[model samples]
Target: MASKQASVASFVESAPPGELSNVVADIKALAGNDASLLQSLEPAFRKYNEEQYATVKLPGSSEAVIVSEHNSMGDNRYFDTASQTSFQVEHSSQTASAVQQHPLESSNADLIRSLQKSFSKAAAEHFPSSVVGIYPTSSDSDIAILLVANKYSPQNFWNGRWRSTYTLSPSSGGLKGAIKVDVHYYEDGNVRMSTSKDVDVSNASGADAVVREIAKAENKFQEELNRAFVQLSEGSFKGLRRQLPVTRQRVEWEKIGGYRLGQDIGGGRSK
Candidate 1:
């Protein structure tokens, strides 16, 4: 059974021991500001990425001066690869050896789908002047990430137990700006970054409205434009969580099954 799971799982080579220090540093940074976004599940999430043996850090959501979104300069088309899709119930496992692999599990798949739905709905709920997206969904091992591309796209991670927040590499569309993002693993851990900007040039659904709003609200609060980003930021996100305090509440299956729970081809984190 372990062999079968390994055959189906996606695997990546671990970074040399030399890179371990950097990875640990990044995860700690993420834990500092984005703990609430993770909290209960970071431990399990780290376990799933056993190959990496580190919590994947999410990058900052945006650069300073989040200008009015010009018409989406990104492409609108995307393809779903069976191997590339996230949250398969089959994808969870603890790697006995760093080389061990596993398939996508159902719980993980659901998490991806949920986050994707969140991004789609944001277009309307956060409409007119808001931009949203999801990307860099890693389908390796039992670990996966579907980042919500808002002013600050919070990267959502799934082991079996699902958690979301920002992280450095194994990340998709990163936050824009000079602000750096990092995190520490409650379990399996990793850290990454890029010198280039993680521009979301693929999703074009809400481009028109986002563009219009950016044009309309050009010189307003840099804070206002990145409300979702700021709201989901390390400090502000705490306040937002206080209002919702995501406790054990039953979600009407039908609600999530219907339009109330929608997923865009672009990206929505679900599970």
Candidate 2:
């Protein structure tokens, strides 16, 4: 079993630019809308969160920042600020497999690997201040008991964090039997019910009864994963911006602020 770190590192370092399209296509093929790669990454998060880990990268010049921002809007809305892409390239007149078979052919695989290494080195040099490990994702129902702290009663939407993440390969039985349980954070900072089968984030039979049960029970989880799945496979999210706060009929943020009411502030105004 290749360490997920090694695999991720490889993806970051060796993936090619033009190959992103094909890679995304391959991911879509594998998870079928399992966007953000979470469809295949939750298992790793569960296992690694117990003992967090991170790369030794510096900031400023780093190519990407593995950022972690918390949204306490009674929901966990966390996402990686790191660049979300990976790819492999084939430059010569021959395919990668052909290159491998023909050994001595001048190929693009080497160039691809070189590019990835450069990116990786740049990342480590710049993002030295970033978190070492334990990006978050959640399963709402499992944390039902510890609700008061959030001031967020079971609303129509999910009230948990999202980790826009991915892994080199799907866990367990590929995507089918991947055993990543959803983790519930407590209002009091305790780990709540970590359910075995993410009520909504699982794949059961296509039977109507099963789908219905999964829907009612894992509504939020299912919805979020589905959205990410779509975003990752489809290359973008359909953003619906939140309504801006109402502006007082005459209130202006810029105009009044320039005029200070203090001493000599408006001296050259209207003599």
Candidate 3:
């Protein structure tokens, strides 16, 4: 039991983002419906969710310690911080099979594949190291595409990621789509923002045309999102925080403690 638990921890610690579900599924298979064991793993998952990876490692796998940023592109990146060795992790055959059989691929496999190819090409060109995945939705005609871009700059004390999901489906106009964009920018501190918008792809007449239109719509959507992010970062956020006190500065309570001292009347302070 101890060995099994340690193996579970090892997998969780070394597993990269976009591949954790597969890890969990494999662990569950070994545990064989052990509810308590699954429940006990919650803390490990929570720590990973909180982006705590300073001590992440995979024992007996590599002599060098692995340093990974949560959701960062490329697995096993910067495996050794001292020498700065960038190690790329190879997926096991079992893991590869799990990825190929993603639950989302069960429905509308062809459409999902089409969108995956289109988005993957764009991602490779425009957003290097990003991962693109397409999934089928409950609705037969609706499909969802998820694109993740992550990076970390330790020298600058910042780590950030962009997660965008687009849902495309048939509509009266032509092809209807909606996009949800989530950004987390952590520089000295974390600042998160999310936004969503609905878009229309017109003039989608045939099957091939529909694919082309969807791709075009996604490009346009990304452009608009880019502008909006810039505005928020350069204009709105700065304006809102310009007057705020610096986070690192200490407050001198002794100096201003008596400035607004409440008046005592009849042994009680006035409201």
Best by lDDT: 3
Count of clashing pairs, candidate 1 = 64
Instruction: Write candidate 3's Cα lDDT for 33-107 as tens digits.
Output: 798877667656544533322223233232222222422234323222222233333222111111111133245
User: Which sequence of candidate numbers ranks them by TM-score, best first?
Assistant: 3, 1, 2
Query: Which of the predicted structures, 1 or 2, would earn the higher lDDT when compared with the native?
Result: 1
Q: By lDDT, highest first, what's the ranking? A: 3, 1, 2
Cα TM-score of candidate 3: 0.43
Tens-digit lDDT track for model 2 on 1-271? 2464446434432223123234335545765664555334433332232111112122233432231222011111122212222111121110111111112112223322333344334324433322221112242211110000011122322222222121111122111111122334434454433222332234422223222332344345556667866885566433443234233144355776765544224345444
Question: What is candidate 2's CA lDDT for residue 80?
Answer: 25
Residue 234 in candidate 3 has what lDDT? 92
Q: Which candidate model has the greater lDDT, 2 or 3? A: 3
RMSD of each: 23.6, 22.3, 12.8
What is the overall TM-score of model 1 with all chains considered together? 0.19
Candidate that scores best on TM-score = 3
Q: Candidate 3, clashing residue pairs?
A: none
Q: What is the lDDT of residue 242 in candidate 1?
A: 57
Q: List residue ranges in candidate 3 displaced over 4 A.
A: 1-112, 138-141, 169-174, 202-211, 225-271
